[model samples]
Target: MFQDYLFFGVDTKVHYSYRMLHLSHLVEEAKQLHNLNTNRALLLSDALLGSVLLSSILDYEERVNLRFHCNGDFTIGTETSFQAETRGYIECNENSEVVKQLDLGNNIIPEFQVRSMRSQRKKPNLFEGLTSTKANSLEKALNEHLAASYQMNTVLKISSWIDSVSGKLNAFGVIYQELPDIPEEVSIKLKKHIDSLPSMKELFLLDNDADVLSKKLIPDITKAVKSINPKFVCSCSQERVENVIVTLPLSELSDILNKAEDLEMKCHYCNKNYIVSMQTITQIYASRNQVNSTNSNEMN
Candidate 1:
């Protein structure tokens, strides 16, 4: 059976601490909470390093955020899952040549995803580990992500196969968390135990199943894996983007009008952009003025 709490070496070094999470339990909660498929779930573990990111957002909660930026064949973005599972995706100017010019230096094929963060804000964003090359290793880049965006120190060692060749879905992962309250001595023992563990890919494929593998790795980790959660959710619509344009200052709305007769916006997480005509802009500006005027009078 998989054991979560264990010892690596003799101690005086034996100290008391609580850190780490059950990968299976994490996935089960996700399944019960979302309309997802078990077959499509992945643990996304940095198995080499022993860590994972865990997040859950309700239909209308403003707590979830994701950003994507990569200089590769694919696009980049950030998104949120809102109430009733409604979601929103955002990204930088993807149409430009900035992607093609990336320089990956002596690293694995570049992959970037700021999958988790300590908090979400509406301020200007800072790009982390954006390689100067066409590609870099996905895991190393993520190390930068953990440090820069998440503001949480992490070590990620991910190992999973990528096979676009077969056109079949096949990927599994695991995430190990280190609780902040863990004392330094206990931390040392845990790290040593983690080091002695087998490779994640081998551990990930134990007995031909991810859940089974999770058990094999930490049978007593107090983990619960009922079913896997559904990912690949997209919730973008024209009305939402319209609401965004309406919030812009009248001058900003007029500026879009000056540049062109219409404005186009897209969801970065998914490859969907929208077109706003001059008439649409005019009405948005008009509504914005009304709201502003009412606020002004109320203030007086």
Candidate 2:
């Protein structure tokens, strides 16, 4: 059981930043929770790893969201907090055309519209970027978004390998960004080194932790500045579901009350079901009327 972690470090002299992520466990958990096939599981895994990598650019208490709007109304998304907590979801029915196409071994990556958003806690403002790639690669789209939107020169690599015998997934990613203060010569050398690194398949075959991988990425990095454990955590709860129901129109609440049966809701991320009984619906309806009446009196 390999523990998942994100390792952060900086070049001792050039000040360039590096982030290495080992998140196969998180991806495995997501695959099990969603019951995804290999194609869907790989897409979600990449999105999850990419989101956590993108979170390294944010400040404390900030969060980043990565989304892919695929053809056939299918979508995959992931959100990662600075604390390294992450969740991801894929939206498409098993019998949908998109899943059918995937089953047929079609490559739908080129039709994806990728969106990245960053925001801080309690802040209403968001910094967002959208980009499309004809390359049929998620990493390329992500790099294009960062370059076009944030004006950052970054190299990102994401890789995954599944054990044939055990059916276990092994995924990792590394990002390198040159700081503004880094000398142009040093930046050029860093790019050359990055280009000369081993192929993703070769890298994945090596048994390495974040520390070892970070050093491999930037040999000058003496120590990691930060390390975070990334986990698959969905922020859904029964209370949150109730709150969502309370926001619905009174007519909708009344309709649920009329049925006299529980309204069942399933969380898309975790597939957990929550039952909202008629009693709860009636209470919500009454509460809405009470609030409306009080507002009318105050207005008068």
Candidate 3:
């Protein structure tokens, strides 16, 4: 069973979270949309898991977005809500030489960006960290980001099993963070205790269960404070897309109106294509003009 949750040590000195995803289906859906090969698909899976762990600590209305800009074959990104609904994608030129020799670790420096996803606010806040891919692992890069950017003493573990032949994926992972004001020696002892546990890959192979693994790792954890079920969810829809189309500058809309029978817009997150008919385009134009006219009159 797919499971996601947050738990804390009995004394609340440390916080932990985990996610187990039967990612084959979601990865297949992504592969079909983005034409992902094994390596690119694998990168996307890692980003998703990272996003899930990062977002788990956020407030209900807040969301976290993770973006990586690298010299690898692909620059991967993910956005996840506190509820654990996540979407991710990879950006790259398939024909470039870089793609031919794509290695996630080849990049000298990569930026990890975290941002607020709220739109109604005047300005959203952004926090970012920079790290080198010298170690050639996203996990290490992210741990560095946490330390450097947020000053958080966090250990992030991400793991996945993918079929080489089919490119199918199964992923699971966890994050542990030492809470502030804890004694340094206690922190060291606790971290060492955690380090002694099996790696995520080893744990998955042995039990395939997050709950069982969590208890083994932190026996005195508080009862599940919250339970979350995360999935691949997209926020694109016809009406939402239509609203965006209507906001485009009139000149751009006119170019589309004159040359194209229908406008095709593809979502960057899910790769869903939406085709807006010419009639809807004209209607949107009319509606925009009406709003502008009303505003002009009000100003007069």
The number of clashing residue pairs in each candidate reads 29, 0, 0
- Judge candidate 1 at residue 293 and give its lDDT: 96
Q: What would you estimate as the lDDT of candidate 1?
A: 0.42
**Tens digit of lDDT per residue, candidate 3, span 103-172?**
4433333333332232212346554445554545677777776666555577778776575566467566
Q: What lDDT does the true structure give each of the candidates?
A: 0.42, 0.80, 0.66
Let me know the TM-score candidate 3 reaches against the reference structure: 0.75
lDDT of 1 by residue, 14-93 (tens): 23212222233333333333332322122121211122222321112343444344544433233333211223222223
Taking the tens digit of each residue's C-alpha lDDT, what string does model 2 give over 1-300? 669988888777746888888888999889889988887787788788788988986664478888888765578888888888999999876667756877566765446688888887797888888887665667777777777777668778887657677897767888888788778788888888888888554775675754456667774645568888998888889999999999999888887887889999998778899998888888889999899899999999
Error of 1 at 293 (Å): 6.9
Model 2 pairs in collision: none
RMSD of each: 9.4, 2.6, 4.5
User: TM-score of model 1 relative to the true fold?
Assistant: 0.54
Rank candidates by lDDT, best first: 2, 3, 1
Model 2: weakest 10-residue lDDT segment is 204-213
Instruction: Give per-model TM-scores.
Output: 0.54, 0.88, 0.75
Q: Candidate 3 lDDT (Cα, whole model)?
A: 0.66
Rank list by TM-score:
2, 3, 1
